[model samples]
Target: MQQAGIPTGSTRPFGYKDDKRTLEPAEAAALRKTVERILTGASPRAIAADCNKQGLTTTRGNGWSKETVKQVLRNPRICGYRSRKVREFNPETGTESVRVEPVLDDDGEPVKGQWSSIISVTDWEAVTEIIGRNPEPGDAYNARKYLGSGILRCDKNGCGSHLRAQKAPASRKKPEGFFYYTCPDKRSGYGCGGVRISGPETDEALKMLVISKHEEEAEDRQATGVPEEWEGENELARIREDIDDWTERREQRLVSKERFFAFLAKSEATERRLVNERNEWRRPVLRAKGEPIDLRGEWGDLDFVEKRAYVEKTLLTVLVASAIRLGGPVRDRLTPIYRGED
Candidate 1:
């Protein structure tokens, strides 16, 4: 039924009415707006909050959540497509798990559903790619309120753990806001537990460093020339999809080894080159309209998600040390390494 374009399920999707196939005007509109906002750099948490405020609920009549928003956007059904479960057995566990993948026809084309799409295929892919990668945004608790929460690392005696935002009382060095990017101690069952830096100060320092690096990259691009928009995103998606399909076919014994290996050698080489190209064109900060902006001034306006995404892109890691070990000044206590740097 789904392959023939008829939407089917135990319960109608969030944007559909009781009939299951027809779109509910209000719900569909909200879904569309949410997709647009996410593509424009709005975090899932922000969108989920907006939905809950507007009295929107999931198909199960529960409040909106960041994970729910991501799941809905990643679903191809919103783009008028059908998906099926690919069950694979785990050898070690002696159990099977399943993955929901797009339903493909015999000709290797996606099965188009009969229901109308809430968003275009292009927009849908972009949404999925964004929500799916760059550290794969976790649940609400992991939504990230601090800029350096996950990006900053503890460099205490090789006890490397991602620093988290912790509350602290006012101190002489950190006089305001009363927060620190403190490393979890043995009580947390991990980490050196000794690294604690002023939260507000660390955030400000990292922001400026990222902005400076971004500025330098932009200046370098001026001579070499850069594209107006990031290209090959859709192409990369297609390549990945093709690779998955090829592997699935082999696992299912639908294709012989000779055919699979022939495709793999060529596909893997192409995927590698595209990945390198993407890394080269990486922009650490992008707010809206995909244009250059004044990072120093506009940095405060961006939400936590955007700031973290930008920082993670530009720097592989920010290895932070305690005041005693990292002497000199606040800036000297940390080392920022650019992504792709050795």
Candidate 2:
């Protein structure tokens, strides 16, 4: 008897035929397009919505969902690797653990299948990294309810604590409680000087900053004649070419092994950085198509979660400065670090 190679299952992955031995041209194209969109900063939710709007269905013939889109993007099978489920019994715990292990070739690398690959290994890895950077939805208490709750850095010159939301006690002047973003140093008694800022006031100031910076970016784009529909596809292509060139150089013995590895690491790092920047660059275009940038007219209409996502996607960091006067208001400095701008 001979050992089985690829599984002869009735069902196949989305980008392959039912026999799993050939590429379904349309499906493969769709998968590649999705990867390109993701590299340009399309969120899973946005991609899912677009798929459904276009009447695209999953491998199982169901409408696409965010989780479904994410699972498809994360699937190694799309890269032409074969995987199998292994079950292990745990006698001590009276349980079994199941895991998917990729089949390896003689070279100890993941075995390539007969089917075509829809995405390159590098692009797949970049998509995975981008997905990992996004925050997951939370439950009741853990949900983001205030802007800058998880984003604001400590005001102390050298302290690195993140500010957390604290509810002020009810009083005669204000029966309802108010929220303040206080430094974790004070909350945890770490001995770093404390800083607190009014949540509403800080939120409003941040909104203004977002609006002003967005306008500036728009003007810059107009002056530079950058296309509104431009994505980072060209830049990604250049980075991929550089990576291939370095690999060829190392293979041809034109560079020392140590130097080759160092340069390869730097090239990969630059690729990741470029992917992030491309995503940021596409964000404004996506927002303009989907949601209105009503920072002034409809600012209060957005919920806490939406507002937090907006801020996190737009700004890299918000550094709060402690009040100069003992009883003065705390000040914050914004860094419009999105779109690879310093």
Candidate 3:
């Protein structure tokens, strides 16, 4: 077994060292810090860059890459556990694989502490499952598709400045085909004094706003000294445990011919809450994995209403003073309403 890449002794091999042994507390802490950095908004590439900047070496003594970072994340040893499998290839028969049962104690639970863990077992599972999703274009539903659309309103109290479109000619020879947005209150007999911006110009402004907002949020997180990588492992573990307990209770009631409806309701409620929490975590991860918005490319895919909604959501209202009509296609000019922090 030792000659076949299997350990013969009681000690387990660690990736970080040439001679494998259980991780010491200091090594565990370092691993945890690395995991926390990855859990934050940083991409694997970014994490690798940071680690290299700090002069840290991987188990192979080489600089870390995104692939290496991902591999480490997938390692079960990080959860202080190990897995075993046996593979066999036959000439007559197809290749076959077998997983040896875990070296269990009297209670049948797998042994623990084979290595250090950056995150808890439960949290690690959640993160790996998330990493398995498709990342190609059109595989994700982006939430920031709306930037300058009229649907986005001032988050302030009682100052909901409405937006409306304006039509203008692109050239002297053409009669129409350009459009823009402005404060609807300016024409609705309200006291909204705003300027007009061209449709294309407004689109550009909204795109800039979206990019700027992303930057601002990142900066805020850095400024507050907050731990960007929160350990959701506990919450996830609790949710799973709750579901299992509820399910067992529900089954017992049904088997005993007693009222199982109450147990069923409790289980359903717990499951719903867990699902909601999971979705919340998933949305940001999905967004982070999404491609950057291509203003020109996406325009042809959306019509007036869809474009408007996309703009409204993506832009900060203050950045869009108003949409004004400029020379372009027939429906060009628009006035944008900007409600800054006055």
Candidate 4:
């Protein structure tokens, strides 16, 4: 049964079908998108809030939470690998412990499962790096209170540091402190230290840009289509089989040690190239249906967290130039660089 490659559990995985070998299209796409978001520095807490706001539920029909999202992100099953819990008894300590580990093949590689992967194995490992990170302190995982706090960048000549949200010193017009975006001199390391703008004004201007850009992309995406299955799958399998065959031949003394090693290196290099192409070809399709036509209308009711998530999904980074004057339109010193830009 261990080598049969059949999923033993009755419950279907989050993004797969009942058989556990077929993808649930919508759920799989969502999982892929979530992985991409997490890899791009979206906090799990913020993602959970956004999921709940959209009335989305898990495969078990349970409401999303920070832990649940993290659990899914750390699961290797999403990337087409099988894992099992092995119970061990320590005679010296007289204790029993259970731990989960990925099932490996003879060559010490994780056994690939039947279900299509939502993301590449490399991406899954990258997401797992967040497991030990402190979400409160690190800029990548830290949750921002302002819409463009960490998403906006300093467009200085050689410095492209992210801007932080902070309060301005109290003044006559403002009783309390004024909120604005500024490049952190300490954090930026070598920032030019001249980029600053009103937080409220910058947020307003960026919000419009995100919505307008999203609508424009959506219009173009309607004509785009997902391609057929990647043709390189067979090529990849053949390469692996060739590797195993050569490995066996070397052990049997049919080839010289150096010759076998050189062949093995070349095989691994070709395999890597094929795997890269396969991964890029299988990127999650961006469905045009069910997406909001105008995010501006929904902007009024959204809280700060939701607004920030919306902006992150649409814009790659908003580059803010140094203010040229005392006061002007927020759009004047701002430049928006949307996602997918070269």
Top TM-score: which candidate number? 4
lDDT of 1 by residue, 277-319 (tens): 5644442222223434456655765566667877888888899
lDDT per residue as tens, model 3, 32-105: 65555444433455556667878876655689766556656665556655545444555576655333323444
TM-score of each: 0.54, 0.52, 0.40, 0.56
Worst 10 residues of 4 by lDDT: 133-142
* Local accuracy of candidate 4 as per-residue lDDT tens digits, 51-76: 88888898788998876787677667
Q: Give the number of colliding residue pairs in candidate 2.
A: 0
How far off is residue 40 in model 2, in Å? 2.5
**In candidate 4, residue 170 scores what lDDT?**
61
Which has the better lDDT: candidate 1, or candidate 4?
A: 1
Residue 233's lDDT within candidate 2 is: 73
- Candidate with top lDDT is 1
Error of 2 at 182 (Å): 5.6
Write candidate 2's Cα lDDT for 268-336 as tens digits. 888778777765655445344433333444345445554566677677777776666664644433333
lDDT of each structure? Answer: 0.74, 0.66, 0.49, 0.73
